[model samples]
Target: MGWLDGYVALVTGGASGIGRAVVKRFIAEGCTGVGVMVRSAEQAQGLQDEFGDKVLTLMGDVRSPADNQAAVEATVARFGKLDTLVGNAGVWDFFAKLEKMPIEKVAESFDEIFGVNVKGYVLAAHAAAPNLRASGGSMIFTLSNSAFYAGGGGPLYVASKHAGVGLIKQLAYEFAPEVRVNGVAPGGTVTPLRGPVSLGKQGKSLSAIPGFEENVANVTPLRFIAQPEDHAGHYVLLASKENSCATTAAIIQSDGGWEIRPLR
Candidate 1:
């Protein structure tokens, strides 16, 4: 039997990239059903085409409390209960330095980055907390190397991710003994991770940056760039109470050994 057999989960930003991989992996691990929160109808349609009724696709922005609540309610309504809430939606700052940005732009970018990366997680946790507590389930958030170290992105993106570290810790403390809270921090992965609109980089993706893969591989201790799937198993491990029952307020780093990267 799969680790998540009979379990139900909700994954925000589940339409593409790491979120999509997590949804697929959760299903393969025998999740009875999965609720996917996406940004567009096209993404919902794509998920439906691929997973059919196995997935409940909700088109909404993660930054909205109403949308977050709706996603949780709809998931439990369809699946009978909620077992896991994966907060995986986020935006990059495209490495825009603080000094380089126009004063007005910094404020806008900060809001947009923190809105999606930090506020989104908080909203999801708030919306899913009751259901997850009822089921004695867990919460998992997608973090980044920026959460721990520097150079991952600009001040806004990095600081937002660092804020996630605090959120997970505090939430884990608050949810204790009933619901577990944790995170997965992935390093440089090849994905369509977009940037903040305020920086005029909403259309830019990390993977499209010329030589990004080569640059990441050269610096990463593992000597290779990761794919979204490379980090999916960490989510499974954390979500499976059977495996990680003793773990909470913990973050699994699936970032190509970034912690041990050679000093330059």
Candidate 2:
């Protein structure tokens, strides 16, 4: 039997990148049904076309409480029960530095980033809490190695991820024995999470960190960039009752050992 054979799952940002991979992986695991909440109608349609009846696609922004609630409700309506909520929607402001960035600009960064990453997770969890409790299910968040290390993002993005770490602990405490809460910190999956990174005040691109190919070959010990599928098993494992009991508040660092690289 598939790991999620009898369960229903909701994945936010499920149209592309890691979110897309998670959706694809869960379906392969024989989930009873999969619902993907994305912001773009075009993207949602593509997913619907690809998966046909086995998947449900909703077009909505994670920043809206109504949207979050609607996605949860729809998942239950479609599959009859909701067992897992994967808060995988996140944003990164890579094109600017904190000091040189204007206050308004920084605030915009905060709103865009936290709106999806933090508030979205909380609202989705709140909406799904009842159904998850009924199924004795779990919540899994997609975090980044930035949560632990500095320089992974601009100050604002890094701070937001750190907040995610706290959210994991606090929610785990709040959810208790009936529902489990955890996070997976990925080092660098070759997704579009990064963009024209800014230097100090010049809006310079931070592309010097290393190209995707180089990051895999020169930085990661595994000597390869991770595809989204590389991180999918952790989600299945965390969602499984047998494998994840007593595992609340835990963070599985699925990163490629970048945390230990000696400063050169």
Q: Write the per-residue lDDT of candidate 2 for residues 1-264, one digit (tens) a residue.
A: 887787799999888778888888888888878889987779888898888877898888888999989999998998899989999987776734778878877777677777777888888889889999999999999998888987667777788788899999999999898999999888777665533222222233233345655755477766666878889899988988877787999888887887777688
Among these predictions, the greatest TM-score belongs to 1
Model 2 residue-pair collision total: 2
lDDT, each prediction: 0.95, 0.82
- Model 2 TM-score is 0.91
Candidates' TM-scores? Answer: 0.99, 0.91
Candidate 1 wrongly placed segments (more than 4 Å): none
Query: What are the clashing pairs of model 1?
Result: none
| Residues forming the 10-long window of minimal summed lDDT in candidate 1 | 195-204
State model 1's lDDT. 0.95
Error of 2 at 81 (Å): 0.8
Candidate 1 lDDT tens digits, 1-264? 999999999999999999999999999999999999998889999999999999999988888999999999999999999999999999999889999989999888898999999999999999999999999999999999999999999999999999999999999999998999999999999999999888888899999999999999999998999999999999999999999999999999999998898887
